[model samples]
Target chain A: MSQLDQSGAVPAAAENAAPAVSLSGERVLRVIVPLVMLAALVGLWAWYVQAYNIPKYILPSPALVAQSLVNDWPILGAALLVTLKITFAALAIALVGGVVLAVLLVQSKWIELAISPYMVILQVTPIVAIAPLILIYAPSTQVALLVCAWIVAFFPVLSNTTQGLKSTDHNLLNLFELYGASPLQTLFLLKLPAALPYFLAGLRIAGGLALIAAVVAEFAAGSAGAGSGLAFRLLESQYRLNIPRLFAALLLLCATGVAIYGATSLISHLMLRRWHESAIRREN
Target chain B: MSSAVSMNAVAPSGKPIVRLEHVSKTFSNGTIALKDMSLTIGEGEFVSLLGPSGCGKSTALRIMAGLGDASTGRVEWPTMPHDASGKPEREIGFVFQEPTLMPWATVYKNVWLPLRLHGVSKAAARERVMSALEMVGLDKFADSYPRELSGGMKMRVSIARALVTRPRVLLMDEPFAALDEITRQKLNDDLLRLWEQFGWTVVFVTHSVFESVYLSSRIVVMAARPGRVIDEMEVDAPHPRGVAFRTSLEYGEFCRRASQSLLSAIGANDHL
Candidate 1:
């Protein structure tokens, strides 16, 4: 895609040849199609529950879930705040730590050789398995949950950023050397900017994983109280058999996941829209 | 080859600014990229290392630029200025086969890079960067990103970046090899204009016989398979050579001789 843009004329000609109406149609379809599919799926699920007269505990109707969503807003909202706090905090920490570690690792092959094995172990080990250990060792339940999320989210940023740093255009590296740039100058002006698209890509992946890790860690900790996240509330509702409220909490989790994805994608787009291929909008 | 070594001292008028004395480069994989290559580039001269692929033309250029070290022999910059460290200062600009601009940077910032690395602030480098862009006819595009430009435009940006520091010598390794013929010819003319205007010694590496004949003051034809210089010829054409020269009898004659040298260079490898 970047190659196409770099060559310029061929893609420009192709872009101009594309009809304007179809381009606008594509823009419209992008949003409308997904919404239409979502509405249809919800309608089908609601209809099936109503027609079958399914028990509320067995399968709460969409309307009943919506009612529960409104009625239990204060409780669910607070739980959501707790989960969001953990997720964002973990993601922020992972982003900074991961990038710093990646830069250090790329500085020497020996450093990378020493540290990458441990990073791989962290990435491969299930958060569920580690969450209990973290909970036992951590000073607080929140700290444990944050640790779990960080473990899950940090690897992609580190690995992808490392690759990006190493993959800087060889010619540019030589050029920088020719100009007598210092190591720090090369890192900041060249490698960091070159690695940004990769970092953002990792951030997008880490964003989703952070939320997942937060939920999973909360589940594993299972500490129920006013400070508990939605995951605990989910367990509590399940044990109580309040299915509609469970569905409401589940809906909130799904919404939060989408929001995180959307937010990260927006960040990636805004940062890279002017240059990176993945972020640049191509007409078809 | 022995005769060509003697010819290394035969600069037209100006002093020998850069001299490669019996330089040979062997890669770690044990491929000898260059073997006993001897060439002399005079001040204000436009010399092209013309050869087929694997002829180590780019390698020789890189060695001169101090981007690579020769396994045997030495590169001497007899006329370059010395820094406080007593080492000859790196007073060379290089353009790769690819434009190689940072895609994220605007054209202005891309041109400002070498100056930035030299500890010149953006405000200090602004006028120089703009003038470099103006030389490439891209001053209006200072704010544009590389992706927003065409192939020729990007290459122009690369040239601007190389020129921003006002180096004493410009080393180009097939910088226009990827461009279309029309754009290539236009750049060839523009490059000649710059060379004439600044009087910077230029060592352009290219495989095209016609391009070498058209643009060079001297063409050093090289052969592949442990690449070595095989022949040297002077164009000796008058300055301000343009489209008229490209279609002239003298241009055709130079092109024919350069083409024969190039074909023989390739044929020499085929026999081995």
Candidate 2:
């Protein structure tokens, strides 16, 4: 083969047609289109509000929303930080709990039989229904809200991780056993690594839901006096008929959710980029 | 079982290294995968388990590898060496029907798995892994993932992983059945070269007449429906069997006889 290569026997055509990864003009347009559309929508909303002489109370123009955002930066910023803290903390707890439960469930059939039904039940029961009850009995409002957010985030991680652990290639497991690998070796070397994509997928979903649950729990608790999160700001704006601030708060919430998703997705991509098919960049 | 040995037919290089004594395997699903199968593989001999799809060829190979237990009888591995310290012990190397690589890992890591499982660190096992890859002519692809390789290349990596342990016994279950004819022929040649270099006992499973004839020094013909060995044929061919040997009249003669035995075994199995 080396001789053939030196003699130029390998045809250039036989070389694989790998996808070009450079950001060419066509690639730039894919990113540009979404930004252009978003600008157009905002531009149109501003024009419509002005042309129709709409009252600010009913629907504020995009300019007014921006102004509200600028003027209320301190309050909204604090609320944003609070919500972010709750979201990430709840997500961290959920991740640890879910993976632990999933590992235990996979370790034994009896544990899965004993607890899987309850997991399904926990998933089925909407967090909103029990947020108020949790708030009333819990020692502190923040702890109650954290518990609510955790409850919302935990199920997806548990279920996806469990499925991923169970989905390890049977032949690989047999090979491990043939080499006399202990149970712990199989779990750490085979099962957990295999579960990574599933766990990341669950984290992405849980990221969004944790934010939603935090806000929902704040609304249910009605405990807003200085240390509340973005959801409380949203509720306060709505009750006080502060339409522009409401839109501004909603805008921040949406942006935060998108940012959280982007971060998690970026993490997933970076970790799996080497081998997983999902993270691999391919030709269009 | 030792007294009933059939060394009468084999022209193997050495004494029996592995002997299956009245081995029968009945799966929990009530399927009799193998019944009363007996065969002996000599050291440094290239043996093929050739039969139809559902025959117990694969089952027999798995039993020999200690991956599956026989419900009745036993497999005697009298020549399997055991030493104290056992730090670098090389037992049996297995290649399944599929490549069975850990897709999440690179080729180096995949090939490094058996050693890794045996408590050998990656840094310590790197030299062995690289040499094994070089043996299969895939040393350059060590950093590449299994998903990036062609079907034949992936199978080579699988073989490289199997060779990484430097085992005394090699068990392959139809390892080339998925490849194209040209690729299969190329792998057969490469495998023959490796076998000659290493001189390990090989129990290869396959369903192809020409492949079995071209590769094995001895071919064990098996059948389904209570899968069992029905006949065994000695290739009586020289070492380093090349493409010329594959096309020779002697090769054709052995294939014809093996094909007849396989057919008759299957026909007889249908009744039992």
Best candidate (score: TM-score): 1
Candidate 2 lDDT tens digits, B1-272: 32212533454568988888899999999999988887767888899988887788898888887777889988888866643523113678999889999988999999999999888999999999999999888888788877777778888899999999989889999999998887788888889888988898899999998999998888888778868777778888887788789788988889889889878877865564
* Candidate 2 lDDT tens digits, A150-236: 999999999999999999999999888778787999999999998999999998999899889988888888777778899889888
| Number of the top lDDT candidate | 1
Clash-forming residue pairs, model 2: none
Q: Which stretches of candidate 2 lie over 4 Å from their true place?
A: A1-18, A21-23, A281-283, B1-13, B81-89, B269-272
Q: Give the TM-score of candidate 1.
A: 0.94
TM-scores for chain B, in order? 0.95, 0.92
lDDT of 1 by residue, A1-284 (tens): 12332355567657756777687988899999999999999999999999999999999999999999999999999999999999999999999999999999999899999999999998999989888889999999999999999999999999999999999999899989888888999999999999999999999999999999999999999988889999999999999999999999999999999999999988888988888888664534
What i-RMS does each candidate reach, in Å?
6.2, 4.6
Clashing pairs in 1: none
lDDT of 1 by residue, B167-252 (tens): 89999999999999878887888899888889999999998988988889999999999799988889999998898999999999
